[model samples]
Target: MTSATRPQLEPRISSFRQNGMRTDALVLSEPGGKFKYKKITLRDNLLEPDECLVRIKATGICHTDLNFASKDRGQPENFPCVLGHEGAGTVIKVGSWVEDIAVGDEVIVTFTSCAQCRNCETGFPGYCDRWFKYNLGFSRFDGTQTIEDPKSKKPLKGHFFGQSSFAREIIVCETALVVIPAPTPAYELLAPLACGVMTGAGAMLNIVKPQPHQSVCVLGVGSVGLSAIMALKTLARPPRRIIALDILSSRLELAKKYGATHGINTTYQKDLMPTLMEITKGAGVDATIDCVGLPKVVEQIVHGTARRGRIVAVGVGLLTNAVSINTFEAVQAGLVYQGSLQGDSDPKRFLPWLLKMNQQGKFPYDELITTYHVEEVAEAIKDIKEGRTVKAVLLWDTH
Candidate 1:
């Protein structure tokens, strides 16, 4: 066959070298369902000269990933999409247009931003004007794909969250990359910091800004809420009382360890608003942050905030879900209820700031981890859904 007529490779069917041996990952058709793990292959997209390719060392499974696959949440991306937003990897190739990021640099992929928008320029890229297409739109901000199916050569979606990182290799914008210190266990720690930890901790430390002697209640004790608890401890005049509410007993214990002064078992409490009121002596909490966004839970919070208090809802709820609030109470109580994105954080600055906190044993965010091998991803998801683990991480390094 002439060169002009040569067949192109499929999106998820490209060759790679593991210890100098050629290998390939199969890109199967979408099965259309929930986020269940199945064995899949990683493909090399033979990136353009101006693009950079990364060898993913680890990619943490996030609730966002699960939501994308959920029918209720309505992930716009069709089936066969490679889903992973929290990824850390080493740069393996650099395009001609790329300069700052070079081969062998360790980095994390964060929220995609225009970097030109007012919000992005102000260091809040979570609200970037073009984020829908830049991140969730399932292509580069410019609408393009890096990989193609090996056989059919059809374009495959790349750059989910600026890096479709579930596979072994990912292509990303030089600007989206955040370089970390070399040999810094980029696998386990970098992913959570990308979104979950940042959202939880940032909401408390950056958005809510709890004052001394105030009462704060965190409504969910998962990874996000746990991070919030830890962040609270670092603040001057941390909440005099930090209440963590969850149905699980073990998570509540972990909450106390992280800085929560009290843990409420909703299974026994039955009525959350009353319990919250009782805990705060009927004054209501100074701040109530809901890391879980079920309608019922949000409703309880609408009723739980003290007069002039703040309610920071950090969790990602279903797009269809809505909560009704009493306008009279909202006005009479002077409540400041607001939704937070990326905990109102600037990843370029916040990621490093958090690393320092972890190194000093001040964050203890690592304690929330339950590690697993990359191949055992399904089990990790199962553990998280079953409440057997708070957060599950896939470890790429045996060490």
Candidate 2:
């Protein structure tokens, strides 16, 4: 799947006029290995009445997309899947049932939730009963697609994370939409907000909710960890000591810039727990977040957390990965362990709030961005995996 030999799956301009609706999409033909340029197919077609046809300007490439396209993870996606979850675009068309949204509206596509579910009513759609399919099942809530492969003329899944937006257009549910201020940088940053950034920041603001002068430790300063650092800075009353631990020295430096009061580079540190304890003056951190998700890393975090501190697991470890904690110690110390998804936020409110924070310079998340063209996706993923960059955004300029 070299770039030179990658297939050029183009949209049929003639088809745009044939249907009452006009939209384009990128389709993933297979998911057995790294998603090469060849897997993407761009096609213009009609979107359904229950959908909001969107003209995507920019989309974020995430590690999850890489993992979804890879065979290493179980439950491989059905081929010819549309593989993008984070998108910022203009609403070119709206469905009949959707009265709140009008054509030409700007939106940053976020989570997929069954709006009528009890969990959603309580503002926890990430746990929506139908979330398995609506978010990552790679299909619409009805298990259908509004886009198709022009050549085969076959139905393709178009609603990954409620918006499979790897192309110029996507059809999304109005309920899953998050309206953002126009001309914002969501074009570059929206994707991270959808998953990676949300997970990290949410853990801090939503789960841990650290108090003023409290101490906190963040493990693995990758995209998620850096976000936690950013969230800490924006806190109304920040933790007295924010410690960042990671194997990468470069990311640790970025962590410092993002508001980490102390950074422990694991490579140089003889023992991470001991170093963390010394930084906290033996009192230990009030809370610890394990953003790496590896069992060993999680164990270290468990060991480093303060006696009565909270430990939040924000990383996506392999399903087989497991961590052990002493029940007696946990009972005696009163440790709290929690697992959070998408920051435990209702995207409808959170994305807009985050955007406002960014605009106010309170959440200057732009520092994490390293942009790339869609073709550079592989390189971007490589950089992210090797810790050369925190986030990689894909700008689709095919007008």
CA lDDT of every candidate: 0.74, 0.74
Clashing pairs in 2: 29-80
Quote the lDDT for 205 in model 1: 92
Q: Alpha-carbon error at 147 in model 2, in Å? A: 3.5
- All candidates: TM-score: 0.87, 0.87
- Residue-level lDDT tens digits of model 1 in 1-399: 221342432335333332121222223244335433333433335454445777777777788877776666544454456677777878988876566677988888777775666888787888988878878877655555555544444555556787777766777766577889755854788878888888899999998888877899888889999998899767657878899988899999999888888999877876678877888899888897888887777788678778899888887677767778889999999988789988999888888888888888889888778788776777887899999988787766566
Stretches > 4 Å off in candidate 1: 1-51, 74-77, 397-399
lDDT score at residue 34, model 1, on the 0-100 scale = 42
Across residues 6-73, which tens digit of lDDT does each residue of candidate 2 receive? 34323333332343333444445666544445332333245544468777777877766776766656
Cα deviation of 260, candidate 1, in Å: 0.5
Error of 1 at 130 (Å): 0.8
